[model samples]
Target chain A: MPIYEKHDYPLVDVRRYLEPGPVVLLSSAHNGETDIMTMGWHMMMEFTPALVGCIISPANHSHELVRASGECVINVPTLELANQMVDIGNSTGTRIDKFKEFGLTPQKGTVVSAPMIGECFASFECKLANGKMIDEMGFFVWKVIKAHVDKTVTAPKTLHYRGGGEFMVAGDSLDLSARFKPEML
Target chain B: MPIYEKHDYPLVDVRRYLEPGPVVLLSSAHNGETDIMTMGWHMMMEFTPALVGCIISPANHSHELVRASGECVINVPTLELANQMVDIGNSTGTRIDKFKEFGLTPQKGTVVSAPMIGECFASFECKLANGKMIDEMGFFVWKVIKAHVDKTVTAPKTLHYRGGGEFMVAGDSLDLSARFKPEML
Candidate 1:
């Protein structure tokens, strides 16, 4: 039998443990200004329309742009972008143009005004699904309109934020599809 | 300069690429019945007060339980429980007792009525923060009141769901703490 022990710890750091998905670059545009911000707090909210929920603090520059524009591009960066992502996350976009500072290529999107980061393995064009909880919770719900992936990189090593400048990159993939129900597949 | 090509893909399966953190077991109890369900679709929503957002489909039995009780335990399971986690996820708690069948010890939580899985590395007692979009969005907002983590394990390997039955285990951690501003530390 395995023994478990309990310890008192700060709950604020729990995000380091439970955040489920990879850190993403949220690019927003409004009034001809485009900015990319590093984001780790987001999740898939629904399946059919492919809704996504993300929490962007009111303090973030991207928050203002996303709120004003009602659209953003979610760029999925690999482990190679770790340093740039940290730089993007650490600095305020209000003071600097992230695209030019980071030397990232911004590609035009077909659906939204937000430009996708060319270095990322995939990008999702999303429109604000709902903004009801934005004022109170800093929560923005987005619905994916179009998705673009680089088919050349079959398996991308994406960075997973583990809080406090730490990250875990995706390793080998294991298949357990046989254990699931047919409907789930 | 890096070249990126655009390829149209199914938007629904984007979770395969973006899922960032560890898969969790959401345990709920209501009407004298308890259920443990495997969940990967969750994200950290806020910092202070520690809010989390999770999408529980209206079809799952645990969803009904969580809705009725307004409280649950978010259990963070390590890679060891990956198989059992899938089995529990595949099977509905409506027909059988998940606690007994999965051989997961049900431990009383300090803040919520739901039991925590003893085998898990960490457990968070969460109370439903808001249910405004329960019907329309299947999204639940939770506030962590109490948390329990196994103190013995310094670095536990956690599982990240990659859609279908594939998972990416939390691998080596990299420290980029020097790159960030002091306040971000």
Candidate 2:
């Protein structure tokens, strides 16, 4: 369905629904071309071997780049860089150079051919263990080989998604028992 | 290895990151008792079969619960329901009646025995996909068997996580062109 009239089902943009950490714009060099796209659509899924998952569509420019490069970086962004995030999300590499347009720093990562954004708070250098995609919504399954983070600022006080062109930084954390029960912290 | 202290590393509560569609409180019902906890740790790993990745600790009361049940009801929630989200996060089913105490309504799911939350916006019935996890952060890998979003709340806005004790909600979606570029959209 190209467009549903009246959207009689939940049709919220999923991009806005994901706001866990600084969303890293994954920059990948594939077939001699580089493309980056904002992703909050990633997660850690398993424990025995530390498996992680992220979704991307086959049509996405980054999809081809990642496949060619066989890897990508999960950059964690801060709220100070939300505008850049928006720009990356809004623009596409096929039309314009996202690096030049957004002025994001592209640095070489340790393990993967995909470069990491130096501006991100952290980076996860990931390898494509396997991939499966849904036709209606493009989602990618991934596995993480190595990951890293920065804690210069309060790391946990990061981005939160609010629907409708809205985003919220985390409110001050309250220890449930300490604040409410007066016994546990 | 036991106590991972964040020196200059980004540390976050994994529970706080799941952008809320379903706060899948998966657990194992053992010995005729139930133990359930909230999960915002899941993300779409794949699009085709809808593979998901999430974190569950061996020490968590719900850990053993997952081992026993091997199935779960991904109870969807809303921003107005944030308090309930935290309520389940804080109170462990290990010692108390989590469902009754939280005023949760359990409805029969089409695929899984784990009851769906009637009040929430969506439900994804899931089964365990046996897989290995990463070594650094022990997590779990699973797949969604079926999903049910409330047909009544088409385009329902809601909240989700980035870091800390915060949650984010869905926002208005822009034209596909606005989100991407002319070429990709």
Candidate 3:
């Protein structure tokens, strides 16, 4: 396992790690209880306020924790953490401490109580920006207040889930900056 | 470009192609005018109804067309269409007919008036399920009524956009189905 020395990253630019649709580990804490859940259904909603929208099924243990505390950390796990990611999703937080069982180091966040997974290369601290659709759609809009990313890893081999326990690993990057309009970039 | 012989696909399983967060081409038509736009901010919201949530800025020409018609087609394009995808995003549909300008074949959808890009490997016909968040957040919830996929292309080399005109191409797939619980799979 690689030691990820993460540093403070711009909140507005968190989309660079998130927009590509990598499966993320959502860590939440409330009343001294902590949980981690694998989340694949999420999208970047805004740039300035750094908003994100995701579906957290009420059936998950982390749902209650996040709803009660109104905060969570979105951790981007690379291919190296694939096993731990699947294990976290398969297991339940109600039964055991995920951080301890999975052997993941939980570091305290700067703004939120949810601990960021130290093994992950990038972690974004988020607060619930809107919960209006939670009841109807199991949807939560989050505002990323603080972001931490390991600048050493330029092209992180993130995992993108494709149902049935299959994942598409991040691959070659194409720099099409010259093709884009100045304002568009 | 490879000719895609797409066939009818299960609506509930559309998440297999979408969950990975690939850049998609959104095609819409209203009042005999059609437009195509590159969309990166989207996610699968549900399985049963095959719901998908996406952010389409009001400034985009397709927004008005989709809002008025309440229909659109989510087309998944492979690396072959990278140039076209960036071109679509950088250019606007307001001035010219995107289908003709980009030389993309437009096929009439079965359920909706919106035309699906014939060149893309897959296309999902969608109906606006919820427009409540459109005014405030440029959010649109769509219910996929029909799906068409090209069965030959097993692992699609889809493009995942990062900021600054950089894209991470879809790479090697890892099958961890054996690790998953039967119910989870």
Candidate 4:
């Protein structure tokens, strides 16, 4: 993963990123070929068994690999890796090895054959929840087996894509007005 | 719901809003009042049966509610409600009337008593799965009874939280790359 400094853009564009959330970077290798792409239509639907819902467009190469291998890695890419993300998001893995094309490194996963990004601050190795595809109408659901983040990386500042040509960097915490509640009544 | 123009800045913080990628959002009702809050740690374990894993933080009122009512609604909020998201995220329903305080509305659910967000685009009413909810050590699992997104609306944006004063908005489609696949080397 490429590294970059922290950012401080205005709060306007940032809300789009926060409410809709980040476009997650996913990678998978099936039949010896690896692919990467950006997706944001994902949600952790459950907690105990660790379930996730990721909407696949039914056309991306990653969708094919995920269907075949039954697993993939959900990696959180920081803004430092912005250009790489755009490149990975736009390119197909059927022709080139995304890991090598984008200079990303891969590591074996603890639970599944799918590999994790050695550089990403956080990553999850997940297997598909079978028969859960929404009949070509909804997102793909997956079961997460293992997840990790770099220990030394103090704060993981990541990139998020909003509607069109808009991106936001994760920012610092701002406490709510302490009196906002007390004054409400 | 406070409807706004396409790009209005409502002064709400996104991180303070409910986040996606499940942890737990407990459903609780006290003295005939009900509310839900974020469960930051969750997993999507299986696809067959469409199950999800979520952890209920001991501190949330909804945790107690989930156990008592045996059901809850997974309300997916959008970037349009980021400011309100923060308001609900930081404050607890234990003391405040979240819906009233925020001027929001709730609707009856199809499968579970857990109320659904009347305004948000997507809502899932779920039933309790047996033998789920990892020991106090992990999280709880739910058997989804019904998942609904406003069919009238198309191309809706989703939200993502990286934790701590940060968020990302999901964007529109990026058609799968038309780049051709090559022969195996």
Candidate 5:
């Protein structure tokens, strides 16, 4: 596993990694117990306050930890962690310590207690901004307070899940900066 | 522009295209007017009811149309329509007729009055499932009632947006079906 050398990233620009819609590893800690889960259902809600909305079903153990702690680290993993990602999704957190099970290093976060995966390219530390929809739909509105990103790794080969164990790898980037209006960019 | 020969697609399986987190074109119609917008902030919320949650800011012209009609078509556009998608996002419907200006054909939807983009690979007709978050967050939860897909276009070159006019194109697939537990799939 490659331990990423990360640096503090701008909160408003966190959407650069997340808005693309890649599968992320969500890590949470509550009552001295830590857990990690693979999440795919998430979207960027706001840019300035850096709000993100995602569904964390009650069926997963990490959901309980996240609900209790009200904080989590959304870690963006690249294709290098595909096997571990699939395994994490398949197995429950209750049965095993995901970090130890997958040989992933847990790095202490700056703003949250939830540990960040050292191998991932980027990790956004978040606090629950709104929990009104949690009971009704397992939806959590998060405000990212801090972000850590590996600046050296541009165009990370992130994995996008398509269900049934199939993943789409991130490909070549198309820069259309010239086409976009100044305000739009 | 290629007008795909689309067939009825299963509503429960709509996540196959959406979950990957591609930039989608949202088409809306209200009264006698129709509008289209490029949207990147959206996610699949459920499978059985085919629930999808997306942020349509009040500032967008499509917001009022969708709010009044309580319906919209979520069209999945491939790389071929990238220019049109950006142009639609840059220009306002109040200033110009998008369909006529862009020269894109609009097809009548079976479940909703919102016209689907003919040049797109797939379209999902949706009705407002929940609107409680509309005022607070411009969030709308939609139930996909009908879906149309081009079966021949396997591995469509979908576009995933990163801020600053950069897009990540969908790449090769990694099928790990054997690794997934049957029940989980």
Candidate 6:
């Protein structure tokens, strides 16, 4: 007999488990003001041109900034930044500058006005691909224009946010390349 | 010294490491024909309405089916289904029935025309929310109408697709719920 007893469960809090990802810091700037918000709800939408989609509720300060400027930088931090990510994510950027408070230096990006977090292992400068659905769905599609990474750490430990302040770090690198098509790789 | 070094890397392949998530089977049906495609590029866009977004390249057979049918099912499978997930992903559905060829059992969903894979641990019946950007971005936004999970395997082993055919299974569950606000959780 199969060990799985599948059934419909309460959808109320299941998202806490369904939303799996490494937390990243999203930096946005508009009208001479800049802010950083730790975000986990995001996804890669396309391979070539590297389109990305994320939800930033209007309630967030970064939402208006990103909408007005039409750009943002996605900074992928390592596991070491987990606690700080949580701290930044939980706090609001309404009154204070997260960069100064969190001790993260902001560096200018190649294509977008948003600054990249100097402390992050990698950063993707993105230009908004589509913002029409922001009002209805809170969805923002970004096309990555420039990318950067810290190559020294070939085996980088990235942090995946599990709801309720818990996180899962990238563990092992398994090779299944032989099984996939070259185009997919 | 922080030991973290940052540098500009090629933009082409960073997504291979940056996009992280568990492998899922995306099911779509149109005109009485059903098809399944393995996907890793997906994200939770909202909480209350349970919105999800994924990319289905126009090249993929399910793209038109999902667009025309206006619905699809996001089936979360366990690690045991990794090989099959990969096999289905590597092949096309233009000429063959993936369900019969792969020996997967399909069950009817509650709110959507897309059938749920019986073997999966969890399934989310989703209706296409927005398709205006499908032609330009190949992005499909879906609202999850019903969700089902296998309760027996409380600690279900889910597979995360690592680029180049590699996969990562979720590890330990850490509880940081105490630190987060109730609303955010």
DockQ of 4: 0.09
Q: Is candidate 3 or candidate 5 better by DockQ?
A: 3
Query: How close to the true structure is residue A44 of candidate 4, measured as C-alpha lDDT?
Result: 53
Question: Which 10 residues in a row give candidate 6 chain B its minimum summed lDDT?
Answer: B1-10
* Residue lDDT tens for model 6, A1-185: 11111222222212222224567799999988998887777877765656778889888899989999999988777766766677787787476888888788888776788998888766778899878888988889888777766545444466665454556666665566787778766
Worst 10 residues of 3 chain A by lDDT: A88-97
Interface RMSD for candidate 2 relative to the native interface: 8.0
lDDT digits (tens) for residues B62-139 of candidate 5: 999999999999999999998998999898648466889888889999989999999998999999999999999999
Query: What's model 2's lDDT at A108?
Result: 67
Across residues B1-185, which tens digit of lDDT does each residue of candidate 6 receive?
01111222222222222234567899988888999998877877765566677888888899889999999988777767877788888887485788898888878887788888888866777888777778877888787767765545544466766564666666665556676766655
- Give each prediction's DockQ, rounded to 2 decimals: 0.32, 0.13, 0.92, 0.09, 0.91, 0.24
Candidate 6 stretches greater than 4 Å from native: A1-20, B1-20
lDDT (tens digit, per residue) of candidate 2 on B1-185: 01111111111212122342334555434465655576766765544455556767775776665656677655556655667666677765356766677776666666667666656666666677643542334355566676665445544444444324544444443322344345422
| CA displacement after TM-score superposition, residue B31 of candidate 3 (Å) | 0.2
Q: Give, for candidate 1 chain A, the lowest lDDT window spanning 10 residues.
A: A1-10
lDDT of 1 by residue, B129-165 (tens): 9999899888898887776765465445778776656
| Model 1: per-residue Cα lDDT at residue B36 | 88
State how far residue A43 of model 1 sits from its true place (Å): 0.2
Tens-place lDDT per residue, model 2, A1-185, is 01101111111211222334334567777665667887656654543344445667675778777876677766666566667776677664475667677777666666777777766656666677655433333544455555555434333334433223444554433223322222211
Model 3 segments more than 4 A misplaced: none
Give each candidate's interface RMSD in Å: 6.5, 8.0, 0.5, 10.0, 0.6, 7.4
TM-score of every prediction relative to native? 0.88, 0.60, 0.99, 0.53, 0.99, 0.83
lDDT of 6 at A176: 68
C-alpha lDDT of residue A108 in model 6: 74
User: lDDT score, residue A22, model 5?
Assistant: 98
lDDT of 6: 0.71
Ranking by lDDT: 3, 5, 1, 6, 4, 2
Better model by DockQ: candidate 1 vs candidate 2: 1
